[model samples]
Target: MTRMLLSVERDAIATAARRVMARCDELARMSSSTEGIERVYLSPEHARVNRLAAEWMREAGMSTRQDAAGNQIGRLEGAFGPEAPALMMGSHLDTVPDAGRFDGIVGVLMALEVVRMLRVPTADGSFRSPFPFALEVIAFSDEEGTRFGKALLGSSAVAGTWDAEWWNLTDEEGNTLREAFREFGLDPGRVGEAARRPEELVGYLEAHIEQGPQLDERGESLAVVSSIASARRFQLIVEGEARHAGGTPYDRRRDALLGASEAALAVERICSAEHHMVGTVGQLEAYPGAVNIVPGEAHLSLDLRGEFDGTRDAVWQLLTTEIDAIMGRRGLRWKAREIHAAPAVFCAPLLQDVVRAGILSTLPEGVDDPATIFSRAGHDGMAIGAITDVGMLFLRNPDGISHHPDESVSSGDVARGIQALAEAVLQLNADR
Candidate 1:
């Protein structure tokens, strides 16, 4: 059978996919959990994985280093030498608790593979990388925020947005982020050094799984992301008087838990009514809890996300109105504290065109168009957007799962990812 890719290119793509798969499995095994995969930022597992990734980067003909924020970085020079401006490619290395294998790690591995393919001969037997820009693979140390309750720490540092106050953020074990950095051999004071200048990068491209099922539902292997949703997170507290459950009748008692439950429902209703908006109450707790006690207070966490800031704020406005009404009706007091906010980011048009060409190259001529997904999930790109234009390609996740052990990606998609990435590099240089 005839192949669209040259024999060597096919071999490289296949080899790269297998290598990525192997590396993901290896890193998964290095997790902190005994039962499932759990590797937090700046932990022992984080250090070990950085070493492993650095080793792989070196093997693939790149100069590797760990940035001041503890992110693993590898730079591969192109036709020009080391100082040449580079196209930054990568995703985070951090994972949520009991995480799956492929969420962030796959992107980092795919980045390395792209560089490997660049170093080899093309169909025309070219010795040099087709692109004018060099390539850099970054395994960002913290995007999940499972430990510090703050995402994009590593990428933020690289973007020169490092929050000095984050050093005091603590974990479940009461270990401050500053202490964790010290334990991981990273100097907290030097984190500013991780920041990269705007002129140093050509742009950024990230390969990540479509955390939602759009690609799977559309029967496509990949999707080019158009935008990542803006997000706002809040801590909600509902206060009421505690009383003996047996003595407190439903009509007579002030139940904070019930009030909080209504607030959560209001969030869902308000957010769902808005186009492409999502609101989730991911955490909830009641104080002085007992089987028979009327809860005195309820605390819940809310995460609201939308395609645009105006639309998201509209939902928030409606939600707050509903919250006030709910509190007033329940004779309870409620408060909301904003904790995190990330604005929506649209991919650059030029980079999107390039990625579209890359996707087309992997498919048969005149085949169906690849899907375009609006990403509701967050990524390092949001942080990197501060420094340069950004684009992303999404691999299909059949189960539409994430942040759990069941998250997965197909080997075929991995191979296609390699091919598509190589084509993107060629297209960018060709356009220049």
Candidate 2:
């Protein structure tokens, strides 16, 4: 934790919610897809958003730059100047296909608003001249893994966990990440420059939508996150002979599609047997397109996540055992590859208290616990947690929808988020 000088007076911020919404809507149109939102890592849309965000950062009275990994970064130095550590803020800028306007975009805009509110000079009735620590906002380039099939790439670079092999990663268009980096005006060789030493940051705070129904169901506007879930993904291939539907006898047929179907059902069954865990077969495809032919092979993607790593891994073990049984009974050969694994990340207790205080400061009396939900979704914090403490404030989403066009957030909630986030920063700085 870091300490800062405390003061009483400050400039007021009134147009936060409107500004956040306007910025979000503006960024949504910068998407590469004309039909829907799709801003992948290092794409033309990525560059456009970074430029737009940098301009906004400048308007908010901060210095801005794009890191080697292409994350858009802005910093407001504290009284101690550039050598002083910072309290990191903001979230990823890239979005999923047909995405809504507010998912990651709102966090960035809210952060900028916080800066705008802070930038007012002492003549206008502001507090703590020169500040105590820098406020750094990072718009991580990719957290959705939409293009490279690997999430947290930009954050990992900053966390010093960049896997050297990722340079060769290819998108659906067969474009290698290295080539894309070059095209995006970044040098792959200098990516390590993006990493911040452990001491360079006081902590990382991310503001995002709940992405689930809990906050909405509770009728609350904001809540502190306890933890982000651990997740593991697998690519499975089930192989069986392709046989003509008319020629193959029912008893003799070894259908790969049937094996995949059973496997999917098994995932549902086993995951339901546990609490705080989910298994999803998001993609399922069978080979031999002709309707007359039995499937020669089937491919499926399995995403499993849980509140704890031990529990998630235990489920994985059980799933593998179940898959073996299914393959043995079906007379099909199967192979599986583990594509991604990220362990659970817990919010720091100190930061949680700070966030709770901020929430309580804004919410009316008789509100329930500030720490109301455990995030089952992954976030950029998972990577930043490698080097520093992390905390999160989740805004309400009425429909609990995300990664889709239907995603939404209320202006009132955004306003609360802005106030809470600013208060959290000030309180944390004053704590020590």
Candidate 3:
């Protein structure tokens, strides 16, 4: 199918981009933290953003609702009526601790702008859609999983993959997820109702800041996502003998902390040698309180990722072998408990083509091709991919800094992104 030209004007794109930036600033102020943005699932901040998003959806000429899982949804029915399949677009509204304002918020706002441009105006104070499939924009309630330590809680329900055991998960304050649902004014028993059948959705498209420096390093504004990373998380524990630091000589000491430190370095060395693979030891703790005491135990968290599942596992194996040698030489016994694992999710070729055409439409003359990059970060699409096809567009983030206050994207880039996404929707219609 041929790509379609965008009908949206330059002024409209600029206006929408400005509006998105303004809304992002507005939402950033609603954070629980005085220091930086920190909105989590089932909190008062979540409710506040959902209400604000609903208002924007109505202004864009769509009917809005909050699903049983607390995800915010807005729908514009096609010519075939309400039951018709929908072209879905959106991203999560949740944020990690000390998050920047534009990570997921911009994607949800961009989806709204795309709908505003596509919905046809009628003389009778009503609107109509030219496409055969309905259009939906979602602001998912949870994606960062900061509260319960389980990511994709909102999208998992929508994908019909919600694990019943998740209801028992608790936060740092000892509040269970079941209680949080009731506190949020949602019935836990009805969460199953949030599931959407695969047939009801045509496909999913999301626009987000790159969260990395790939685009910025290459002097490009945007790129089409090729796939999301495969990931595995583990808690590693190292055990050794506890003894008096003052009396024990260096040759006689069996320090667990030293063993764990060596293992962490080994992780960096092993992962760096592999292509598209990365390992991070984000947290480390040593037992014993006093500065004079020798530590008997050490615990560290490992987060490993790669572009492919097989290669990711291979790197894990190599890491384990290196860690075993390090621990054995240090006279420490170590163990690793696997906590989480997810395979890489590739984008559909059809969706990739349309997204490429969308990015190309925004470029200057003679710039016909767009860059393609694999996302090292996890997204809602990882869970949503269980039910439907997914595609993503990435806007450049300066210095690749994310999850912090310094993260940023230019207003010009946001305007171009809005036009590109609108063009993508029109191209999808033409393909249909």
Candidate 4:
């Protein structure tokens, strides 16, 4: 059999990237929030974006459909017949409030580009012969968990890991998730049907902006992900007595805010002492937050991450232990609850090698060493990894900034990512 060169038109890929970026800007503008780009799960704006993406998929000549979970999937049939598994690629579409243009959108757009480039003429002089296996481009909904407090909601549903009880969950405004689903024209009960049988998936791939400075610092355009760090989030609440800020005697006051601040500092100190360990108190709230009043309660959320599960768990335990000691010493009542935890994920070795080879084959000369690093952030690939083999490619982010409006990746990096991704897909398809 003759080896077909799998290549994408540079101009066409650039055009697709621009289109994706435009859509991202539009989505960010809708439901704008002070925190970031607030496209909440199952909101009207989210549906609109999904519909537009579906239309683009169809226009690109792929068979597109929306799953019960509101995930948009575009399918390109394979010449090797229906018996072969598919090459599935995508990432989430949702973003935090006031987010940048590239974060999640790039992955979805690149998937579309892969499908467009792979389209060949059929034997009957109609559509071209498909690749060896089906190609699926998915735009996963609700990955940020900004609305429902659950990340990877769409991907988890498709992976058959989503809890049915989540349907009963309501936002702060009392809008149930089921109601949100109804508003989006999807049935909540049928979400389980979105799961793909193991036989249907040959492998999964995702290409995303680095969202960190690893690639930029290395002066490389792409990085093959080796692992995703383990993460644990905790809500720590400290209780004290509220009193007039000026009237409360320093000796008599049980200041919850002070205690919480001390705890946060301890977390930072402990994490810094441990190599490859990180801890952050990203969100905190104080009751009766007034200039003249002493805070009675302090509630803070701690996010801990590490490259190894044991290290992460140990750091978490240490943080909690120190918090207990601080509470005892400060004579403050406190409670801690675990909000979320994700284990470290290592990409499949074979798939990582394939991606590396593809990158080396496509990039400019002397761009030989692309960084191999573990992600400290979670992604849709993590959930999918639970069900099947998965891999990821990270494009350079010039400043290591993400989840903010200033997050960015260069055009040169994006072009390199497209080439690498295209080659990886082709190599994987040719394997079977």
Candidate 4 per-residue lDDT over residues 1-432, each given as its tens digit: 112332426676676566656666665666546555677788876887788889878877777888989899988778776576788898878877777767888899888877776678666643422676788899999888888787889889888898877887787788889998888889877888888877788888999998788788877888899988899988999999899999988988898999999999999999999988889999888888998888899999999999999999988788879989998998898998998989998899877877886677656567656678888888988788878888999988888999888888776666667767877877775664
Which candidate leads in lDDT? Answer: 3
Question: Lowest summed lDDT over 10 consecutive residues: which window, candidate 3?
Answer: 1-10
- Which of the two candidates, 2 or 3, achieves a greater TM-score against the reference? 3
How would you encode candidate 2's per-residue C-alpha lDDT over 55-131 as one tens digit per residue? 98877778889998999999887877788888899899998888888878888888887777665354544322156
Angstrom error at residue 206, model 4 = 0.5
Per-model TM values vs. the true structure: 0.96, 0.94, 0.98, 0.93
Model 1, residue 344: what's the lDDT?
97
Q: Which ten contiguous residues of candidate 1 have the minimum total lDDT?
A: 121-130
Order of the predicted models by TM-score, top scorer first: 3, 1, 2, 4
What digit string (tens of lDDT, one per residue) describes model 1 on residues 1-432?
123343458876887899899989998998888999999998889999999999988887777899999999988777676667889999988899899999999999999898887774446543334456788899999999999888999999999998888889999999999999999898988999999999899889999998998888888898889999999999999999899999878898899999999998888888877789999999999988888899999999999999998899888988998999999999999999999999999998888878888887788888877888889999999999999999899999987999889999988899998788778877776775
**Candidate 2 segments whose C-alpha is farther than 4 A from its true place:** 1-14, 120-130
Stretches of model 4 off by over 4 angstroms after superposition: 1-36, 124-129, 365-367
Model 4 Cα RMSD, 1 decimal:
2.5
Q: Residue-wise lDDT of candidate 3 within 1-432, one digit each (tens)?
A: 223333438888899899999999999998989988999999999999999999999999999999999999999989899989999899999999999999999999999999988898768887757689989999999999999999989999999999999999999999999999999999999999999999999999999999899999999999999999999999999999889999999988889999999999999988999999989999999997468878899999999999999999999999899888998888889999998999999988888988988898888658858899999999999988998889999999999999999999988999989888988888888886
Off by over 4 Å in 1: 1-8, 120-130
For candidate 4, what is the total of clashing residue pairs? Answer: 11
| Model 2 lowest lDDT segment of ten | 1-10
**TM-score of predicted model 2?**
0.94
lDDT for model 1, on a 0 to 1 scale? 0.88
